[model samples]
Target chain A: MKIGAVIKISGLNKDFPGGVRALRGVSLEVRAGEFLLMLGSSGAGKSTLLRCINGLVAPTSGRVELNGVPVGAGVKNISLREQRKSVGMIFQQFNLVRRLRVLDNVLCGRLYYNPLLSSCFNIFPQRDVQFALSCLERVGLREKAYQRADTLSGGQQQRVGIARALVQQPQVILADEPVASLDPKSARTVMDILREINQQDGITVIASLHDVDLALEYARRVVGVREGAVVVDKAAVKLTPKDIENIYGGAKEQEVYDGTYGRLEYVRA
Target chain B: MSELKRPVLPPTDRDGRRQSGLEKLLYLQRALIIGFVLAVYLWSARGTNLSLPELIEGFPHMADFFSRMLPPNLAILKDLVRPTVETVQIALWGTSLAVLLAIPLGLLAARNIAPHPTLYATARFILNALRSISEMVFALIFVTAVGLGPFPGVLALAFHSAGMLGKFYAEAIENIDPGVVEALEATGAHKLQVIAFGVVPQVLPEFIAYNLYRLEHNVRQATVLGLVGAGGIGFELITSMRLFKYPDTAAILMMILATVTLVDYLSSRLRARVI
Candidate 1:
């Protein structure tokens, strides 16, 4: 891990309407060029933490800093948005505009860099269009550029989502369960792509996942969350059966771990 | 342990019995609602002097008027053409003006897109007030204010249609998938950029659909606006009727019907393409 943290979350807390405390004084650091996986069950606050890092959800208290700039609620509106341009996000649902062409959807990622008037007019410069196309190519969906986003299958749409995020040229990519909605093969393909991006481009990746075996296969660092707090934080290779038990509310960790590892080996073959 | 026996009885309430009292109360409530509806209908009928005998007695007079209106006048068709075209023009201009004015108002009134609650509420109130008054009433007011012409008729239709279109546009805006807007915002898009990309594309087909529908309605209303001397086929119709020119009246009615039918068909086709 690098010495400098790319993203810093210190004592973060988020209380939603109706007094739901989604995050409870959580603090973590993401190093430069690291593949960090956040493991949690549903409602474990992993999604909220990722959103807070990207300024989608403001922390009720504490601070989130991206590239040494404050990005949470207290930051100025313009600067907060400016900081957000450095971070890319992928959702589990692949939230592309269904009615828009895939190319237009990818171009939307560069909206922060373009002038308001030009972007509104949809007059993307040729260079940007080429760049968007190259990003789509990287995701292996170049030929699907002109297709309506909704017409694509679940896996293909998620690849389009990846292309959109990649087009931003962000230093950090935050993915909230990017493969949770896909089949096993597609999920592995997405993970491999994310891993490749992390390795080749050296962009820091923080993804939340429900699948422990996938995390073991891809993540260099793992953070386990249970009920809005980190239960375990360590290197992926160092995580033990006890840590898995702690994260999953004392399920049969040894049996699950062995079963998952066996599947991972078979999948790798 | 022996074959895992299951209950055979039908499910019931907590007391293990169906509640007859509750069922009886529900039935009674439905009966009372029907009775109240019937009573209200009868009361309204009496208040409005809507008697079946009266309608039956008036059929012959209607027949006599229709008989006099026929033996049709094809000669006045050319004279009716100019005013018919003018009525269509009025509708076209009014619909265009309403669309232009309503876009901003509708954005302001949409709850999700409005910058503030106060602005949303105020815009909604203004739209409601505008829609409450009929187009004919607005025509009458504008005619007195701006003097009789197609211009006043256009203004009246524009104002009335703006209220209706604004309400519909706001509803379309409000019904958009919030996730798309969120994704755009997460990309650091400005408010205008969010609206252009996220909101506009999703609601545009509906907006065009509503505008075409309103144009069709406005064309029909434009003819009636001329009744108040606002300049269209209606003015000619009223004049011919007062002078007992039944043939001329019949010709005017035919022209209006043909124009409205053509417009309705074209607008429906356009709407089909849009949706």
Candidate 2:
């Protein structure tokens, strides 16, 4: 395992309290500038794998090396939080502090760098504020920076979440089901923004997705997990309906495979 | 489908008898709770030397005092005004000092802002110690140290109120949304910054309201401390009582009641606006 491979994992195992094994001997490599989609059903260890990479959840056994720094080992372990600052994460819930102004929420990305006095004063250096504004403009929410975060629509809140991550200037962005709470239109918009961030800015994006079409459309590479094991790892162009069926399993009413199923059922109901 | 025969047995246990067991258990539980409450009340009363018969016997004295309070002392109003203003001053100064002292104590006692367990626990212990002593006891001690004056009364109210408000402020800090704190932390702000940005804003309104309440409470306590020679309207009232000038004492009581009502109204309005 050459350290030059960037973010590398080997024999990662995690068993939560009560002996629920979320990940077992999970091993993978995430190269620089790679848009990797960690695909999985509920309880399939995709989130745990992401959490382990950033040190949010420690792996019971195994080594995660990020940028040649050892993670999840003793007191000297690479502080995933410091690493997390460099590598931004977005949640399925958007996770914005609703009472705060959108600009303040976005500026939280710089929390790891600012002093208490500075943050309290909110005297973000003009450059930092400019950067945050530019990030907002990228996500098309520049006008809403002064508004309370809770006032925004679901789509806008998710965009604000993206802007928050962007202000971190992350090398890698891990989005745990980023579009799970959005409508189909909003999901597409968020996915497009992620793809743009990946393509234009050259930031690596690894997002978890349940929608196979979404993963297919946005991700360059999709790694499927089932029961805490990576079952399928392939380029998007190589993925087939058969491979997806293998991922979701064979107990659906047929239309679940099609992208319009979520929309159609609600319309009919 | 032909001829079928049915046999019936005699009713053995009464339905009421079955339910009586449950009813008995409930009654026993209720009696146990009532007995426990009474036992606790009696135990505390005995320790405090608060005897019912003593209180009953004092009713006659209370009647005598009220009779002396008749034919309202309107003439004494001019004399009472000066002492009344002194009482208000004591409360105002006491509340201001408490507010100042409580700011640091409250932050230290707050679970989120304390950062270290030892520091937090120490702050909490100190606050608890301050709050455990009654304000009158505090006044007595401070009066000995500083020499009997409204200064001692003010100090006593400040220390006691700070203890109470510190605990409340800490609890308010604890109840805030952790998500906001985490966000502030993520910004690379120091512990103090997190408290300033994340914890303070959430609890400001509550802190303001609590301070107003403490001010209102201190006014009443200031009157009582005056009886211990802490200097206020109570000092004048106590002199009249000692001199058997019941009409003058009645005048002071009326002033105290009016002052209390006015302070209460103002505090409620302030609290309402804060909310």
Candidate 3:
């Protein structure tokens, strides 16, 4: 809606080949340097929306604009790849090349800038390697840089994921349920790292989260989706229980909305 | 409180039978399969005029021939050494050439990695055509074309093994984890880069293992390729047998066996280490 919005989705709709309507005419704007949390049930189009931003899943109709450039269905492969370079993605599974060393997995983020021959031989420049090591250091995983990525704990693997994204030097990071596979403590640690990245580095972060309390604690802004449409959009502090009720209608009350504000106190204490 | 408790048992049919209709049918089917196999074996034995008495009568002749070829003609071992080394060389060269040709074909034939359906189908068709012809048949053709030598033997092995290795490579590529590929693609890597960083690392060890297996197989095939005059130890065995030099024939056979055994051991060890 704003003139200088970093990511703009307008009337975006994505219908999968099997006729599943994952998104329906969704419109949203993400400001630069904001930590935006998207809340939704399993099939509520949150992941699809994030994928659309990076051109991973092409939208069926309408458009998604990133930094004033159109990126969606019908964009050229070269331009789409260029657009993807500025939009880092972190997955719930921490999808590192499991057999490779942690440093090599993190260096994958710099593949766009490296020459084809160098990337094939895994010969990154010294500066890029140092930068990757620093990103690992920032995530408290500098010691595990030489270890195989699969040998680490779940939280440690996610920290590697963050380090990989950070190596891209991206303007925006899209984390699709980054902590859904972690225990509560590890989830909190990942959220803290993402928040630190957002606040300290001024990187725009759009994270889709399942936990309401975590979203409220870490997000500057929260957008709620129901079925395939946004149902609520508000600043985190101004979010109300009634808005959550509309988003999760007909689901089990206690499981979906019961622990909304209670976990905040637990996290604080 | 004084009464003893009884454990509950599973319910049965009204007739109190343990076997169900499905179980009865399964038993009948198994019995029928066994009977059919027995009948086929008996019919084939009768048709081929197989006689136990004839086999017993032939044992003495086999023993006589073995006795004539006794001691393995160890003095001729040096003469047989060069041919054995040539056979192994043929196998090594053939397998290396096959690997070179198979890599591109396999990349094109793999469904997930192929850029277009037409390319995939064409590559698959070529591979199948290559596989349909036996290695011995190819050896015969190449021997005719090249006028007889280890060159023809090598060519035959390379062409035939390429078909097999290419199919295996395609399967390995298709089976790799898609998430890793997606992660690479999300980082703005090009198509070739995705394949190099994502697909190659996942499949390299398996490709190497398969190549080693093919090398072992090709070594055995190379020994036999010379039977059709493509030039190897088989040529020596055939000549010695034709000339009635039983001792020399025995030496050549032993040499072939030893070479194949060594190749098998080395390939298995390499595969164990790689995988």
Model 1 deviation from the true structure expressed as Cα RMSD, one decimal place: 6.7
B1-275: candidate 2 lDDT, tens digit per residue: 35677876537756436766789999899999999999999999889999789999999999988998886677989888888888989999988998888788888787666756788889999889889988889889999999988899999898988899889988998787764555444433456666666777678889899989998999988888888878789898888889988888788889999999999899999999988
Name the 10 consecutive residues with the lowest summed lDDT in model 3 chain A.
A260-269
Arrange candidates, best DockQ first. Answer: 1, 3, 2
Question: Which one wins on TM-score?
Answer: 1
lDDT of 2 at A14: 73
Docking class of 3: acceptable
How high is each candidate's TM-score? 0.91, 0.78, 0.87
Candidate 1 matches the true fold with a TM-score of: 0.91
- Chain A TM-scores of each predicted structure, in the order given, are 0.90, 0.88, 0.90
lDDT tens digits, residue span A1-269, model 3: 23369998899887765456778889999888989999988768787788788877777798999877798343544487788888899988888888889999999999998899878888999999999999999999999999999999999999998998899899999998999999999999999999999989989999999899899899889999876789899899999998888777667422222212121111111
Clashing pairs in 1: none
**How does chain B score by TM in each prediction?**
0.93, 0.84, 0.86
Q: Give the alpha-carbon lDDT of every model.
A: 0.87, 0.79, 0.86
* Angstrom error at residue B34, model 3: 7.1
Q: RMSD to native for every prediction? A: 6.7, 8.8, 7.2
lDDT of 2 at B268: 95
DockQ of each: 0.33, 0.20, 0.33
Candidate 1 docking: what grade?
acceptable
Query: Which stretch of 10 consecutive residues in model 2 chain A shows the poorest summed lDDT?
Result: A260-269
